[model samples]
Target: MNEAKKNSHMVGTVSELSVMLEYAKRGYTINLPTTPARYDFIAEKDGRSVKVQVKHGSTFNGERELLGFSKTPYNKRDVDVIAMFDSNDGTIYYIPTDHVEGMTSIRLRIEPYLYSVKSEKALIAEHYKKFIG
Candidate 1:
């Protein structure tokens, strides 16, 4: 049987669900908002809650990729954390919105580029894994 085609909205929903599952597995209580809002979920644990915005990541070069948090900037009040689901490896990375405050997107590197002497500081996705849960 042929698989059904997926569009952006469908992909986004899948990403949100995937992130929700991950959060649940990590012992978080996932709460979905009833109305359309800036954040996708409100994850709570130990009496603490975080507003999470889910974004899908696309891979470019084999070693590096970019994840767009928003077309426009959003304040920390709108989203406490940005959960990026890597399409390539099924890895979900959590980043506090404050880290990329006022930015539209972030470039993620799998590893350092040794040959480039003036390489920009890399935002490795794996490093952000610590923010999960």
Candidate 2:
């Protein structure tokens, strides 16, 4: 791989590590970044299982925030919680599959969504609890 690709991979790895630590500090036991082997981290808390996808912030040069989701094809796997780490400030965020619906104003059409990360995570945990346990 080219140096740039290598560097980006390194950054992503670091970001995933940071994510794991954050979840751990929040009292969740977590699996490290083994994503694209699909799924980044699997966190378990209070007998709940939550799958997470960690992504770095978008590439932008201007001062304005370039907030948006990727328009590439997705399977059911990609629709789950997509977490992002702000490269500039390192704030972790959880974006659910339903968040794509918020793209009404964008050229890439998306559906309407209404739910917070806490709720989404809770639902995910409940759904996967059997397999996780």
TM-score of each: 0.83, 0.62
- Write down the lDDT that model 1 would get: 0.78
Root mean square deviation (Cα) for candidate 1 = 3.4
| Ten residues in sequence with the least summed lDDT for candidate 2 | 104-113
lDDT of each: 0.78, 0.53
What would the per-residue lDDT of candidate 2 be over residues 35-62, giving only the tens digit for each residue?
4534677888888877776666553425
* Clashing residue pairs found in predicted model 2: 101-111
Q: Model 2 segments beyond 4 Å from truth?
A: 32-36, 66-79, 101-133
Identify the candidate with maximal TM-score: 1
- Give the C-alpha miss distance for residue 90 in model 2, angstroms: 0.9
Which pairs of residues clash in candidate 1, taking residues 3 or more apart in a chain or in different chains? none
Top lDDT model: 1
Evaluated at residue 29, the lDDT of candidate 1 is 98
